[model samples]
Target: MHNEVRSVDGGSSLVQAQYIGTVNQQLPGPERVVPHETPRALRRLVGRNEQIEACLADQRVPLVVFDGLTGVGRRALARYVAEQVKDRYPGGAYYTDYATHTVDGESVISAALRSLLRRDGVRDEVMPAEPGLASLWRRRSSGAAAVLLLENVTESEQFLQLMPGGRDWLVLVAGRVESRLEVREVGGETIPVEPLDDEQAAELFRELSGLDADPDDPVVAEILGYCGGLPLALRNAATLVVVGRCPSLPELAARLRRSRAELMRSDRGPNKGNPVFEATYQEATEPAQRAYRLLGAYPAIDFTPPVFDLLIGLDEATSRDILAELVLLKVLQEEHGRYSMHPLVHDHAASLSGLDDEETHEALARVVRGFRNAAYYADAAMIGVERYRVADAPEIADPFSGDRRANGLAWFEENRRALHELLPVAEKIGLVDEIWQIAESLAAYYFDRKRQADSLSSLRHGIKAAEEAGNRAAEARLRSLASRPLTDLEQFEQAGDFVRRSIELADQDGHLVLRASVREFAGRYHDLTDQPELAQQRYRESIELNEAAGEARGEALSRMFLGQSLGDAEGLRELETAHRAFGELGDSRSAARALLITGQVRVRTGLPGGVDALTAAAEAFQTSGATFYEAQAREALHGALVVENPVEARSHLDRAIQLYRELGSPRAEKLASENDGGLDGAES
Candidate 1:
């Protein structure tokens, strides 16, 4: 009887005994674990009714593979089908885009598994390592009724890694037609999503363009033929007409014909290039054309207007106007004020840009510089200027001027995906200094967001970049910071090596602040490994070096760690001193951290006022947007109140669980599991 069912009222109850001849058993709860929301289907989906009906009718099939060419609406069809059938699966509906998750052509299965488990309330602390993730996913997903929508799947192996070990699950996979056979072998029934028919294409175009022209018009017919019935192409052609890019349908048709001729001559085959995209592109002004070409060189999937300006070396208003024009022409897509090009359009733009290697390099260099500078400034604003930043903040107009902290953090959040995508591009373009500096600037934000995997990846790139440039100080700083993520991931051996290398480099460089930072990192590594004496010794060394180097912030941080490791009255005093120092230095985030540590020690030691300290720390963390630390403070408050104040303790525990859940932290599961029985008892 591993069948524990949670009732709708949120209570565990055994099944009726009479059904099993007086044998009492609990049934598993119907858990809804929709990790990623299925993308909404197109409102004006003109001609997929048959495919949708077929998919909905086949309730017996475990896997359905929707295979088609790029931009043929495979994902749209899959999404529509999943939305229709999701209610049938009580467990949950899950969605993942393989294009965004893959690295070097292989799926990062472990990351996907972690996402699944975390959404299922599995805490990171108790979750098994990468080697055991796939088996664990199968075990946990066994017998669960669910729907999984996997988009851009390259091969069958990626599907196998995510396949649920349940008979009642429906997995909808969308990929290119070439990937259909391998998936078919894995019990996936193929459903080919083809291009629209002429009538359907006309309907969709009319819907998108809002035009009153007859479908039988020769120019309209010519334009539709040039589009080849591809939904994306149709949309582009229709958008051009709607935006008044041409005075009449005949003019648009003539433009498309001319562009088609140019494309056929330049491309490998007549059908190889999209004439709709070419015509729309050709209609753009000179600045917009240059912007489109340079944008293709931008490695990120999406970017803001400021980033576009940086890439093209234009004023903000001019860049935004260009983006608006492209968006109107459907050459670029704009969502939430972020502009992106479709894969086909991006390829066409890149191929025809005619930018020499030097121009490409220069354009990329500008982008890297912009990112590096913005990130460094944002980091300083968020964390304060006391921390040793190896990169110099140039005296430029601050993009995040008013309310620097909030704006800076918001900018980072908005651009996080693009920033991550830019790292490798920077490396490839030989922007070595920018690579390491961007990594360093992003370190605090990454840590706060609990993006350990991303942090480690960027740090590795930064390390290589630093080494290539033969910059010991930068390498040492990056290595020191790298230890944080490695330690967090429980890779102590690797963390220790990074710390050791950082220390060696710091010593050779003879920069006291750098030396102190690396020593502090060493102490953190030792503390995580439970080497208390060694940790204390390293912290003390760090404190002395920081004092000598006149780095007050570094000294305060080391003191806070020293106090936490010591876990005694003297440690409490040290924490208090560090908290005061941080307050005086205007580092509220660090002060809150110090208070959190102090509160935790007090709670563990059964000291008075521990609840008060933890409450204050939680409030500070909440206000400062330090979500991870806020969760910790809440958990600590629960610990301090669970005995005498069970009611309040449960409330705190619930809040902590919610915070951790929002963070996708593994601790959520552990905390929920530990408090489940007690909270139920408290409620009764």
Candidate 2:
């Protein structure tokens, strides 16, 4: 079922609507285009063509300020020039308009950035602080020739927060003429946009009016003269004539003559801009206008037609048709079927909508539910049911279809970025179960990609959501999932807390399988924290529970972990059994981990088969794509082989160090520690 309730034509609370705007361009989503906030191409720029060409060619100054008195063509020139040079910037030429500037520096930067990230499908959360968010954006677009046109900026301080760290990045700031002094102080080239001369004014008037051989037309000349050679006023005057509301340019010129002083005053920009928009809007059909206002209520910068349907309570085809009309009217811009209205247009439409706070929240609530459903299906598909499985999960309409035709992993691969952005909304709306389920389900995908921080973040969100929902099982599972990353991070204190909480919850639940599953994490925490004896005991208890429940995977995991703590003869015995169990169960990764542990124990005991065991283990890790641990296993082999086959040992050392460096591990230090120390000397 399509997610909708209220029609764009009228009011219906969105909360009652079940909206799921899923499926779009390539899965994880297409790369973001820089916001060419104005028209993409301009044939002529009046007198500003030379200045625009100069700005386009300049390479030395990374920042350029287009300074002008308020009705001059500062914005038009910057946008025109950026489009000309956009191909040089593969990262994109996005705009950050500041005409709505309230003089709050922090809010200005945050709001603009929030807009861009949403355009990038980073919907859930962005970095909380200005510097951090700026740094994140710099990192995402690092080394790319990206351009940012900051329009109507009143203060240089506002630009500082959003400065891209890249030395070669282009920042074009358009503001009042006086702001040029500060802009110039910051290594920015200042281009002052003076009023257009008669020739330039005639060219602009001709372009706006689409007239041939008419630059010197007496009536057009008279009207253009009243515009004070300002492009905005000239364009506004021309648009009035083109829409056929006026009989002739001469009549409009006479009306402008009556209010000539008032219209040509310092505030002419607003007087020209607003009425042009209002007149254009007055001619739009009801559906297009309603779709315009309805979309203005959306918090995100860009959205697809499916989302538009959900928001406006219109069917997909009708919604898309209306969206096309708005795009035609230039109230919105559409690229590859996604729609984004200019900020100024959005603000105007939003003011006219008269939708109350309740309606806005209701609209957003539907979005949250839709997103929650997508996450739930994405979770199940990416991670499968065996790990941190949930029951009674509501499925969204599967736009991706069946498992064979669909790809669970690809969904996460493509959609994870969007999902991460939506998490904050989940928290805001209190989708408690959905939050934890989505988080816990992401473990397999996050871990496999070596995204430890993302895994830890999901777990943190899951823990809070589970606690809020009073879901003991979810809390236990989420905490267990958290322990692995904490251990990897060497954050022993937190890992210990996570395991202990998980164990307590499992014990209270009194489910043997759950307890067995969770105790493996307890054992892992003990091993990571260097409490080997305690680890062995926890593993034994877990093994006993798994054995009784006939859970072969659980038994094998507990035994493998126990072997690392036991060492020597007992270690060999436990590891051999675990390896056999894993192989029998067709779990290649688990079997490889067991073999690696076994190889370490064998080398310490001076076993003849140690080299062979370590070699096999390293190869398994390589096949399994566990690169870092494979390096460590190679280091262990090098330690054992150095006493005999020194050449092979040196070869192993080189490869291990390379893997360490690639994985960003302490390469030389880890190799030195393992090669010199080996495993423990017979562990008493």
- Please name the candidate that would achieve the greatest TM-score relative to the true structure: 1
lDDT: worst 10-residue window of model 2: 675-684
Per-residue lDDT, model 2, residue 126, is 33
Question: 68-143, model 1: which lDDT tens digit per residue?
Answer: 5556677778888888888888777888876466455433777777877777767776778777888888887786
What value of lDDT does candidate 2 attain over all alpha carbons? 0.69
List model 2 lDDT by residue over 576-623, tens digit each: 999999899877767877878888888887776777888898898786
TM-score quality measure for candidate 2: 0.52
420: Cα error in model 1, Å = 1.5
**Model 2, C-alpha of 293: deviation from truth (Å):** 7.9
Model 2 lDDT, residue 393, Cα: 65
After superposition, the stretches of candidate 1 with alpha carbons farther than 4 Å from their true spots are 1-276, 353-356, 676-684
Tell me the RMSD of model 1 versus the true structure.
Answer: 29.6
